[model samples]
Target: MTTVNADAATPTELNVLVRPLPDYPDAERAYSRSSSLLWRRSAGAVEILHPWTERTISDSVMVASLSELVELGVLSGQEQFEDAAVQMICSSAASEESAWRAYYLNSINELDNGTSPFSPVHRRARSLIAGHEVLEVGCCFGFFALACARDGHSVRACDISPGAIDLLTTASASLRIDVDACVGNALALPYPDDHVDTVTLIHLLEHLDVQDTTVAVTEALRVARHRVVIAVPFEEEPTEHFGHLLRLTEDDLRLWADRVDHAGAEIFTDHGGWLILTPHR
Candidate 1:
């Protein structure tokens, strides 16, 4: 939910420029002056270099999750962060889109790899898909949609975030993968009733309130001919960085199924909690 707004004082056409860190005038002083400077330590810690907001983030779960991408050179360096922030401030529409596209293109290489954290989750989700026509709701960057397409499923995906949809669209075209991705709300899905065989709300419900979650599940069930698949992270407390608002347990998922008009509900745990809701004919 990061919104980038361009300052009226800055030039719309201005592109971010990178210079050697050592050559910059009094690097320490410059870091103090600029609020956007981020420094990466050799020990693998990230330090936000704002004068009043200097803090070193520990090697927590979030850092560990992204470490593989960094090691694989899929993630950007410190300089890129500075540049990207400048781009976001100066010319957000084009630059933000470009940033997302670049990240998607780079990260997809390791996304489905055996060692990747995402690999097992996606593999399990892919196996649970019941039919040929699939729709993945809240498919950020459409990685699963791409995987489904590779499996010969007529895959489509949508997300609430415009930047995410744009990234997915750009990556699908670049990889020559056919996935119809668009920007749409989960509560009010854009597809018609029984439009696809399976509708998946992968890691999406945690971001929604209880009311919206019910509406989203209802919408998915309505749109899916066979079943609706839901996956959520099992957390004691929701992680704010990931924009998670609710910590969903196995019982929570079962309760959700009870509230819906599903023929049956099968709940389990793999990397996270998995709930398969079979729609009534």
Candidate 2:
């Protein structure tokens, strides 16, 4: 665990919430186990834990008191952070056992919200772009990419998953958002040097191992001419086998930003897991 900086601003408060699935025993066990580990790690340190249990392992943690965490970071605004954290918890839980497909399906099906949990961060990044060409690595279902395109920014969305790319393309067409979606990898971006004005990555960096993350950051710098926007989950403790290679903290992100800055790029944290890095022209 990274040591908290005494000189830096401290988090405001911490809270936790839990919800148990009665039908899914395996899920309940997994959730309980993971939540316990997190709680034990974050105990009595400006954090709150919420546990929801139905049958066995009824004592389990579900949601977190995120506002305090944000306050600790010297950030304000609660509703957005709360929403993002819940979505992240759900996404992480679902991803624990290949639940992303179901999660994505449910998100798309329930479009009544128009704004997914990532909407706040996505909207923030979109607001920064004043009609610029944007590139999204690992676009998933093109949710954020489509949002950018719909906002009148030309977007090139790419993902290693062909099915994801196809779905994004199809969805973009239906929404009348002009976007170029492709199948590609983050390490070897399928774009020319300095081709895009902005590069947006949501919950992407931590998906790779440390070494791979370094390589991907290099590639993102290589392709992006102006800015790089990234969002990661800010968890108190490490969860076992988060489907990806590793989990990251603000320190990790700061180190990555330093690397980019050494390479002549400027990095800025946009609260929580969102970062905005701009390269020198």
lDDT of each: 0.66, 0.57
Worst 10 residues of 2 by lDDT: 53-62
Off by over 4 Å in 2: 1-115, 237-242, 261-271
Clashes of each: 0, 19
RMSD of each: 10.0, 12.1
Lowest-sum lDDT 10-residue window in model 1: 50-59
Query: Pick by lDDT: which candidate is best?
Result: 1
Candidate 1 shows a clash count of 0
Which whole-number lDDT from 0 to 100 does residue 228 have in model 2?
A: 77
Please, what are the lDDT tens digits per residue for candidate 1 over residues 1-281?
Answer: 11122232222233333222334445664332222332322223322222111021111212342333233232344343334333322231235445444444434444555545666778888889998999999996687888788789999999998977876788788778899999999989998888999999999999899788899999999999998989999998776545678988988898898899989999999989999998887
Reference-based TM-score of each model:
0.69, 0.57
